[model samples]
Target: MVKRCSWGTCNSDTRYPERIINVSFLPFPKPKTNYDACLRWIKACGRPVEQLNVNKITRDTYVCSKHFVGGFPSEKNPDPFPATGGQIYEARVKSRKRKYVELEHNSAEPSCSVPEVPCIDHVNPIILSRNENDKDTQTDEIVYTNLDLVAHNLSIKNLEEEKNALIKQNEDLKMQLASCVEQDFKLKSKRSPAKKHKQVVNNKKFSAETVANSNIKKLFEYYTGLTYVRFILLVNFLFPEEGINPVNYKEKRKEVKAMLLTDQLFLVLCRLRNGLHIKDLAYRFNIKPQSVSVIFKSVIHYMYLKLGYLSYWPHRDTIIQNMPQQYKQEFPTCLAIIDCTELKTEKPSSLKSQSQCYSDYKSSTTLKSLVVTDPRGSVIFVSDLFSGSISDNEICKESGFYKLLQQLKDQGYLQDNDGIMADKGFRIEKDLGELNLRLNIPPFASTATQMSSGDVALTRKIAAHRIHIERSINQIKNFKIVNRRIPGTLFYNINEIWTVCSLLTNFQDTLVKM
Candidate 1:
C-alpha cells in the first residue's frame, strides 16, 4: 500500500484514483511547534499575525474550500492558520483597501454590503478635487478651476439678483402706501370748514322827505289811483298779512310804477316795440345809449309782472263775442291771428349766448316773441320767452300752445265751425284738422301776380284784414318798456311788459271802438 499522507494533505476521491486529505481539517501532531512556525510565516508576509488573534478552533473560524480558491489567506483574516484551529478563514485585505480608496475618491462612507455616493452629476469634478486637496493640506487654497470659478460667479450673481428684486419690491410697496396716505389726506380735506356765527339785524327806518321828492309816488298814484297808504291796504286785502309791511309795500309799488316812466328805460322799450335802434331812442330821450338799456330793463321787469295776464288766450266764446261782425260772419270761430316777430338785443359776450341770440332774419341778436291778435288789432295772447335760436315750429310746440288748444277742445269751447289764421310759419293746417278746426293761410304772392290787377284787388282786401294783426303787435310793442333790448336780469320781466301792453291795447281798442 502507498504511504498514507501524514499532515496538511487531502486524499479522498475516486476520480483521482487516490485518497486526498484537506490541510484545513488536519490535526496538529505538535501544537506549539506548528503554531510557532505558522506565526513566523505570517510575520514574514509583512502582515502582523498578532492581529489575527486565532486562539481556538470553531465553526465560526473555519474557512471553506471556496475561500482557499480565492487566495484570501493572510493576516487580515481572523484565523490565517488551519492546523491550530482545524479551520481556515479568508482575508479581504485588498478588497477592504479598494473600498476605502473608492470611498475617499467619492467623498462617501463605504459599507461592506453596499456603497453609497452623493450624485456626482450636479457636482463639478474639478471642485471635488480641490476640496480633497484642501482636506489633505488643511489650508483653504481657493483653486478657481473653470467650473469652480463659474459656480462661484454664478452664486454671486444669483445673490445680487435676489437682493435687487427685494429692493424693487420694497420700493413698490412704499409707493403704494404713499398713494393710500395721500388719498386719505384728500378725503379729510373735503369736509366743510368751520365758520363764525352771524347775528340777525332788525331795523325799521323810512325817509319821508326822500319819498316825497321821488317821482315814483306820483307815478304810482297815477297808475293805481291810490296813495301809498291806500295802495298798501288794497295790497293787504289781496295778499293778506304775509311778510310784507308798510315800508316794503311802499317801496315795491313805487319801484314797480316808477320803472315805466324812467326816461332811459321807457326810450329803450319804445325802440324795441317800433324796431328802432338804441341810438335813435337815446337821441329822442336825450339820454346815452347805455342809460337807455338800463332804463329799458328796469321798465320791462316792472311791466312784466303787472301785465303778464294779457298773454293768456281768451275762451272761444269770449273771443267770438268780442270779434268784429265781418270776422264773425267770415270766420266766426277765429281764435287768434298768430305771427312771429324778432326783438333786437345787444351782442352776447359768451359764444353760446351769441349763438342763441343771433337771428338769421335780422342777422343780429334778437329775441323771438309769438304774438296773437284779434280782428280789431288787439293782442289776445303772447308766448313765454324763447331763444331766437329756435325755429317757429319748435317754439310753437315748446310754448305749450298745442296743449292749450287741446284743453280748449276738451272744454267744448273749440268750435268746429271756427278757425285760426296764421302765416306760413305755423304749419297748423293738419294740426287744426285733427282738432276739427279749420286753418286759413294766405298763399305766397309772386312778383308777376303781386303786380296784376286781380291779384292786387284780392291782395288789398287780404292786406286790409291781415294788417289788423300787424297793427295789434305794433300797439302791444308801443309800450316804451318793450320796444328795446331787454336786460339779462329782466328776461322774465319782458313777458310781463308784453302782457301789460297787450291789456292796454285791448283797453284802448274797447274804449275807442265798442
Candidate 2:
C-alpha cells in the first residue's frame, strides 16, 4: 500500500523508515492551527481506505518524519523538531516566507527613492527618505548637541526628578488600566450565557439510534429506571396530540442537531428517574447542559399536563369494587388513609423563599405534600405542595383537601360516619372539631406514659390498613425526581412533579389491592 504523510506540509512517501514514525507510540500535542487540527483529526479517525484492501490511502493517513526533526514527538522529547536544525517542526513559517517573497518582488523598486548626495554612499542608503541626505547629518547634530551639553553644566538631580515624575504618571496609568480590566471582567461574567452557549455547540452529540437501536432491558431501564414498554406507553398516551413541538423544521432535514422526540423524551425521563444532573444528561445526550435544561423544561411541562391518565380520585363505587376483601373485612368504615411526605428541594436564593422552604425536621428546604389514597393503595388525592414552613393543618385546609372531602361527603361518596385514618401528624381534634367527622389516628399522651391495651390494639389495626398509603407514597417516589432533591429550576412546579409521579403509581398493576 502506498502511504503519504498526514501532517500538513508533509506529502512525502511513508515507505522510507527515515520519513515515517509509528503513530501508536508517539502522542503529539494538540494542533494549534486550523489546517493542522483538521489533518490531525481526520488522521486520528482514519479514512475509508483499509476496508477495501486496495492499498490506496486517504490524505490524513500518516505523518512523515519530515514534519519532525527527530521524528514525531514522544515521551523522550515531546518538543522534537524537523530534521533540519533551522526549520523547526510545526513552527509557524508562512509569515516569514511571505515577508521574504514580498521583499524579492519589491526589489525592482528603487532601494532608496531619494537621489544620492555628496559622500552619501558612506552612510546608510535605506533611510534617505524624501531628501538626498542619508540621515547621518541628524545623528551628527545630536552628537554635537550632547558634546555642547557636556561642555555646559547639566544637573543630575533634574534628570532624576523628571524620571520620577514620569514613573508616577506611568503608575497612575497602570492603575486606571487595572480598574478598567476588573470592570470588564464583571461585565463579561454578567453575560456569561453567550460564552457558555458557544462551548455547548462543540460538545459531542449522537443520533437517536443510540437508544432506538438498543434493547430496552439490557441497559435502557437501568439508566431510565423504566421498562421500554412502560416508557412507550407514556409516549403513546401523550404523543401526537400532547407532545412538544417537533424538532424537525422541514422534510428529511439532514444535518439537523436537535434531538428526536423519542430521544428528547428519554432524556427528560432520565433526568427525573435517575435524578441526573443537567451536565450528566448533556454528556449522555451529547448536547450542552443548557440544551439539556431546555429539553427537560419543554418535555416535563408536557408530561405534567399528561398526568391525568396517571392519577385520579376514583369514584366511590370504583373504589368499593376494587377494594380488597382484607381491607373491607378489617376496617369496613375506613374511607381513605392520609399521610404527609417531604421532598427535598434545591435551596432558592431568595431569603423569603428559603425561609419558607426550610424544613426543621429534615434540616433542609423541602416541599411538603399530603397524599390521600383508598385502602387499595390507589392515590385518590395529592394536594398542591405546601411550603415546608406550612403546618400540616394549614396544608390540609389551604390545599383544598377539606373542600375535596366536603365534596365527597356531599356527593355521598363519603358518609358522615366514615372515618379518615392518619398518622400522628394530624391534629383534626382542634382543626375540624365542628365537622363531626371520624378521624382515626394513633393514640398520643399528654398525661400518662403508657397506652391502654384497647388503644394499642386500635393503633396497630389502623396502622396495618394505613400502611397501604405509605406503600403508595413509596411507589410514587420510585420515580426518583421526588425521591431525590428537586432541582431548583423545577421548584416552581414541584406540585406538578409530585402529582404526576403519584398518578403514575396507579398505573402499576394494582399495587394496592383494595
Best by TM-score: 2
C-alpha RMSD for every candidate = 32.5, 22.9
Worst 10 residues of 2 by lDDT: 96-105
> lDDT tens digits, residues 11-103, model 1?
423234433334232221233556654443332222223333335322232222322333334455433344333323333233221111111
Q: What TM-score, over all chains together, does every model reach?
A: 0.42, 0.54
lDDT score, candidate 1: 0.53
Per-residue CA lDDT of model 2 for 38-77, tens digit only, reads 3333333233323311233333344444444365554343
User: Model 2 residue 137 lDDT?
Assistant: 42
Q: Pick the candidate with the highest lDDT.
A: 2
lDDT of each: 0.53, 0.63
Pairs that collide in candidate 2 are 6-62, 19-65, 69-81, 69-82, 69-83, 310-503, 323-514, 324-514, 376-514
